[model samples]
Target: MSSPEKDEIVVQGIAASQGIAYGQIFLFVRSEVEIPTYQVDPAKRIDEVARFDRALVMTRQQIARIKAEVEKNIGPEEAAIFDAHLMVLEDQALIGETIRAFESTGNNIETCFNLVSQRYIKAFSEIDDEYLRERAGDLRDVTQRVLQNLLGQTENALNRLADQRIVVSHEISPSDSATLDRSATLAIVTDSGSKTSHAVIVARSMKVPAVVGVRNLTQRVKSGDWAIVDGYDGIVILNPTESTLFRYGKVQERKKSFESRLLEANREPAITKDGVSVTLMANIEKADEVGIVKNFFAQGVGLFRTEFLFMNAARMPSEQEQFVAYKSAAAALAPQPVIIRTLDIGGDKPLSLQADLFPKEDNPFMGFRAIRFCLEHQDIFKDQLRAILMASAHGKVRIMYPMISGSEEMARANAVLAECMTELKQRGQPFDENIEVGAMIEIPSAAATIDLLAPDCAFFSIGTNDLIQYLLAIDRVNDRIAHLYEPTHPAVLRTLQHIVEEAHKHGIPVSVCGEMAGDPVFSPLLLGLGVDALSMSPAWIPSVKYLVRAMTMAEARALAAEALTLGSPKEIYARCDAFYRARVKMD
Candidate 1:
């Protein structure tokens, strides 16, 4: 996949993040493993079991250490994958099966353990689902660690990345990625991985530019080779020519210039030239990301995804654990409201504790997920509710529910929340009794019922990421149809206009907290539609603010008027692109 011009080779891959980086290539070559097999005496079978138990303890401790490191450097959601590895190590079925084999066959600990692990890995690999099949990678990861311990192999390849370079690797294990030096790593170019891999998720949360699934990426480049990672376009240039380097260097400088403008915009109000005001906020995954909110000068957290608490543990998080996390974020942004979205799990996000509860489905996106899962599992739902309520007393915290299809789902969710409040009241825990509750308008039915749903809630937050997907019946994550997921489609605009119109009618404010909210090109259109607020990743706040400060309500309204008259996404996109170029001078 590389170009014929060796010094100017261009390779394409999946764009895991958005940015540009230029640096020397630092190939992360992993050491190979060779497991040895030997026979054990019949009387020494018990000793083989002891050896296996020791390896398990060592691997668990190692994974915990890596988890803590990743949580500190990256975020808790990325670190949570290690919890699955720990679970695999502690699986009673796996360990018991291995012990039985060792005792019956008089085989060595390595042989018995490898045989049992392979069976489990093979079973998961055979699953038809992509997500379930990915679990096979986890099994292999844990088993490799145990085998490495039994083989006395303690070397690590990612320990010395203190020299700044773009990390080039064939395949990076999550455990190894945790050990990478953030200061030294400018970007990442991997030879193999999909968008769903945890390694890509880690790179994204760290704000590092990355391009994965670059076939033969490692084979074509050597250490110290000049590389340009066009993460915005998912291109990796190895041994880039002088002209190519010069071109990207200017692009990088322009990007820096735009970022400088965003920084300057931080001090400005998110107000239109015509004196219209719009609130700008951040969508955070963990409490630690509150620092980013403050740094970007976000008004508050519009969507604090509380699912991280459930995802980080092997089982349901205790009310106390959940309270501590929610309270920290809310308290950090005191006076400013932090709207915590509770338990948006199921579908893609399966809990390790309740994997058996949800079977495979043909269409998980439309299946039992989000609010549907919460209402069905009230115990898990209530525990999170109690925590959110308890945390509300510490600061201005609000509760929001995701994937609400209609008034019935919202009513059932409100019922469970009320029950939690009653239980908390009996326990005499102080909380904001008047904390506001909101609903996310993601599904078309929810948008259609905004009039009914809005009156019951204090506000509305449109989850445009999923709304656009569901509206178009396109899975944005599926690269095959990702091109069809258009945010600027006429139908999407009309739907958003409907929701906003309905919310304003009920005297409730509506905010967009999805990818559209962060994009500068769509900013004018959204403002024209009269959305009260926009919430996005913390990094987008400043740029969006800059764009917000430039336009007048009259101009934005005119743009929206024209955009609404358009028939196709292509036409709408062309208009927006022209408007953005004129506004930002990005090119």
Candidate 2:
């Protein structure tokens, strides 16, 4: 049953990420093949084993074909996620588990795969964290696809699907997304994801329309179906007719045109029409992302998360290797300030060196983590400082200490910095003595005591994600409290404005390196609040630049003043919304 000529069959959910896009619904259909539990002759075990191997080989080939076909039609960038999916197929974890279970239980591949998947799924289900719990989807996706290959039933519509604008799956496993006609598939949607999730990373790189965390998309959409995806707002509509498509399609085109116009704006200073020059920086986790700065033509790197280098590595990267990575990245993007935050791992990612850090804590979020761990474990702290010092010679590097609470913490940390510098100098290593140091205002205490800590640091980068979490005492990753994670919350805004104001009073440059900086909804408020710079992912550069170049400081400030008076988060957002709607020129 299709909707009327002008009507759209829209699917609604909590909009995770924001953007508008039009695409065909590329349903990522998956079926988990069960391991047969039928008793087989002990003598025929060899035959059964051979059968399983053949099935595995054939499935691999099918998946490979699907990947190749989709990539060829859609474009490699659009479909490259399947490569990650392909890796999962070969993962020893899933395949090995199935084999082990089959060997031990004397069950066929179907029963073994089910047994293994269910066990891992159960374990994942018990986890309280949404990020960890949702990992079950990936586990299930990978195990099922690989099992299907083993069962020789890999042929599916997604294998050779073709489209211009595609409505991607709830979560397009890297391998599954690879097979597509990108021109045909214009947008992507997923049921489960965070901004940092791999699928979104790939989508941003491809520069397509995407709405993540759209639940049950695969089940909601069908083959050869048309859908409207508000990639900017996380809205998906099934069976949107031509007229409905045209209305949104025009908006999509205008958004594209507006982003193109901002390419020049990136090169132009972020100074608003009223002469308020806000520093526009980029947030990056990988070395390759340095290119984003140049591509978006951003001013500098606001938040260079060094944890990625440390967390995903097999072992500690040698000092020389760290120097090379940092040097190459710095030299490549010379002149642009890069604020590297020391490893802020513990709750989301744990270090093997500090296994006992969280001792039976009820809330790891509030546990002995972040800077607390660094203070206790001076050895680890020293190594990271040494690495940063060694790399500073490459270019202008700013050090932003994470989780700092007060002046004493900064003093104690700086004292250790003095010691590390002494050791490095005695060892004949050259370092930057003039390299500026900054502090991440993530915790509420750090913000409250900004006057105490700001004196010691060269700069301040407010990490709003954590600040809001701590101030409200709500865990954003927990579904129950996740909705409360509002950047527009008056308390959150007040804290953000306070940090910027305090930093400016001390003559130190202040920037926002949090996710809020990237959001279009809150970007105006930040500028109005007197943010010196805003750093976010590079993909947001164009959309963000459009708003930045169009507004005057007077207008932004006026909007902010009214926004502050609102009681509800929704009300604050509405005032800001009304202001932008009336002011933003529709080209």
Candidate 3:
């Protein structure tokens, strides 16, 4: 791993919680923040205000250019996420709020910016919706620039770190994640979030290794501490020896080779050696994701995160608007089944109008969220259901309820759905009654009651992330207790096994859309548990799909049986690795 050092050999602390990635360095300095100033020189103040506004316009143009260039350089969908980020650049609420704070208080630009950005960011962070939570980061990134510009600084006047710096921060704010150019960023090191946070999402989207929630990341790794980040296991190493570097260098190469092959895997079908075909689908959020699905040749959109529709809308979105969104998705995927989850917004999703929806609770995890809200508020629930039913007429749509407890809850939910259908029929509104209805087996109670629920629903989507959380009583997002939240745990595996078997016994298909579904090591285990389909991130499609084709039904079953007999989570992981590596080559 030791090579001849150039003039400035840039070595950084890698937050390799995602894995090691080797690519050309792309350096990016965040746009300067604009501070609001009031000099009382009305003429001069107005002119400067105009100038600041003009500069803001130019900054927006620059963001648009970067977005298009990144999209053109990479892929459209990758760029589209940034493009969506750019939308906040032109947002009126953000702009008004930032400037208003300065106008109202005589606070300097930094104070105003600190106040305004923090206010909105806190609000966004409190939102339960995953997609909307990202917007807070977007706003933070832009607002920082606005404040910097207002302070009359041309650049972020922090200490000079490196020509190619991997940011080692206490926490990677969404703003930091958005503004960093992946080409310049060696990797990201932070002390916050599990795999589902903005840091992990950005790293994965950019194919960079990000280690988040390291207790003392900034303090432990000094300036220019030669470090290595293992994103695969969320490990950050400082001042690694030559031996470790050499090992990581090879690991990086092997990882690259494997990823390249997964891209090529899309061209081939997921067929077993004996020729059994497995359906592979991508879980998507934005409407633009449909293109990625087509590009990857995905069988269909397995999970369409409908939460995007509810984000940024005033009040409830009309049934027609919801219908159009679902219809467009259904028509885009055409014969392929679109499992439309009915607004999985709760806990952290920020709904501007629904302050009452998010009641103060001791535990937000077990609080009034998901289907509980639907049961309490029929109008909103019916609005979403009506939209789904209408979309069903356009193409195959499967309606899914999140956080189902038992048959009674599901039956009550369906009762409303039936009323919606009846109303549609009475109005001569065309919709598909054959649209499948299902529940998310994320709650442990739901897993226990799967037998009672199977006969009432069309299918079951086992959301492993939450199931593991509820089963083990550990929050995946909390760093302190995340170690306890292992998906391969005996209790968790048994739950997955029971639900999958119960669903199959009643001739119902059970699919998994959680993180475990995307893991190559767990694919065989899932199939062994009798999972019919796996819906994961669009990027993971080819790898998991390829894995599906390599193992046989008998092999999968044997692996599953062995996993059941395992006593420890570590043993389960070892067994999964050995089982898959023995046959599939782990690309």
Candidate 4:
């Protein structure tokens, strides 16, 4: 089928996964499922409940099998999305509500499940935050699985894409995206999705070009029509002219050359021209991402966010499961250190276990979260600690606690770790007796009281992402005030300087593992601040390394000192921008 008009048309969206591609549009129109509602016989209520249970079981098994496949083919990080899906399927709130609906209205099990899932999907879709909004896709993904089981539907249309084509859809769920033939699919264009959506996560993992949140995209393009997907800029050109295609072809070649250079710089040391060596590490959300760290030649896994294990699972992960995950990563980065952070959930990433464990708070970001939650629930806390300690013997694994506010919390947390160590010893289980422990100095209170907290800790990791927001008294997720969330703010710089000074004074190293750490523009300022290490996304390591290799420690220190003297963010940005421009040129 051909498009009505051939004039060049462009649609913009969030640039989810980076790449460039040209292909014929393969419109994936989702025909609405005709769901019928009716009252069931009172005598058959038991059977109704059993039917729902069986369908739920089938859905869970299907997702779990997919999780295993994804873990084997892609990595554990990508497979973690299915864990979240399983949690959604097993959500008590959702299940309870559906059961109540079935009991009250005697409606078909499929109808009740659909109604409850729609309510959740609608609620998540209306959220202002991008992360929460993207969860709507997750709810829908799980809901569809249950519905498919109830209806006995087999396979997604995505599985039928036998030829290479640009996929255009209303929205691609994580499950649907997981079944996609990445080698055959040229690119992805969706009318709805967030940057943090599971679809985007899978696309990034598969290295497929994707453009999401394009309104009415499915309606704009038809099957067999020529299209161009500029994933780098989040633009989709439908019914593209030959000239436009020619231009993008050249652009693709240039991008390939630039990326090749970045990859080539991977094996080189991240050292300054003056011979000052800096540790460049990767901040991974899961153990599977350790492979990327190796690919990028990162010094180590700086921050292994263990929260994914808890947040993604249907229930709390057992000690043995957590042990295997931690061990896998520790073994992957053997000899080099892998700092495994304990579970840090309850704020934006809520636990899936019970309602009382994670209550809805108006300001959850600053509410009872992180170390506070773990401390209150020691059973959960101890399980994680035991797992970390058990995994330590696999390699150079260190333990780090998140959201440390003062010395008291550090002491209490350490006491718990010690208790776990003692128990492991009593059982004659092997573990690293000399495992190092550290604190994540993200809170303003923690930074201010670093002197007291530093002595008890082995190292400090500066979480500038939270530190900046809290220091500036702004919520970065709040778009109206997001502009105020400045990393180069004067107060932010001062706080970082103090944390580094206190940590160094105590003879401990400090690393920046936030968005700023990955930013090439802020590399000199952070280095000058006396930061001992830098940890960021694996993809940014080489570029940041290139920048590190080009400058002398003296130049970086001079730039940092001048930045400290600046009074405003604008001025600080100017200094860093001028220095970065003078030192490095874009390819």
lDDT, candidate 1, 483-551, per-residue tens = 898998888999999999989988999999988899888988898898989998887787788877877
Quick one: best lDDT, which candidate?
4
* Model 1 residue 200 lDDT score: 66
TM-score of 3: 0.81
Highest-TM-score candidate? 4
Candidate 2 local distance difference test against the native: 0.70
Model 1 CA deviation exceeding 4 Å by range? 1-9, 12-49, 60-143, 154-156, 160-165, 181-186, 191-209, 213-226, 231-233
Q: Which residue runs of candidate 2 sit more than 4 Å off their true CA positions?
A: 1-7, 13-26, 33-157, 162-165, 183-186, 204-208, 217-221, 241-243, 351-360
TM-score of each: 0.83, 0.81, 0.81, 0.85
Candidate no. 4 TM-score: 0.85
Output the lDDT of residue 92, model 2. Answer: 54
Worst window of 10 by summed lDDT in candidate 1: 124-133
User: How well is each residue in 1-587 modelled by candidate 2, as lDDT tens digits?
Assistant: 33455346677554544457655465665444545567556777778678766765765676677667756665564444344345445555556666777677777667777776676566444443344445455556656665666566643334355546565665665445454344555667777665545455456655666777666667666766767777655678877776777788688778677666666566776767777677778987766668767888888888887765654343555666666777777777888788888767665445422334545455666666667778887887888888888888888887888888888989988888889899999999988988888899888888988788877899988888788888987777677777888778889878887888788888987788887888766888888888878898887876677787778888888888887777799889888777667655557
Q: Once model 3 is optimally superposed onto the true structure by TM-score, how far is the C-alpha of residue 20 displaced, in angstroms? A: 4.6
**What overall lDDT goes with each candidate model?**
0.82, 0.70, 0.71, 0.84
Superposed on all Cα atoms, model 4 deviates from the true structure by an RMSD in Å of 4.0
Tens-place lDDT per residue, model 4, 197-248, is 7878888888889999798878766788888899878999887777787888
- Which scores higher on lDDT, 3 or 4? 4
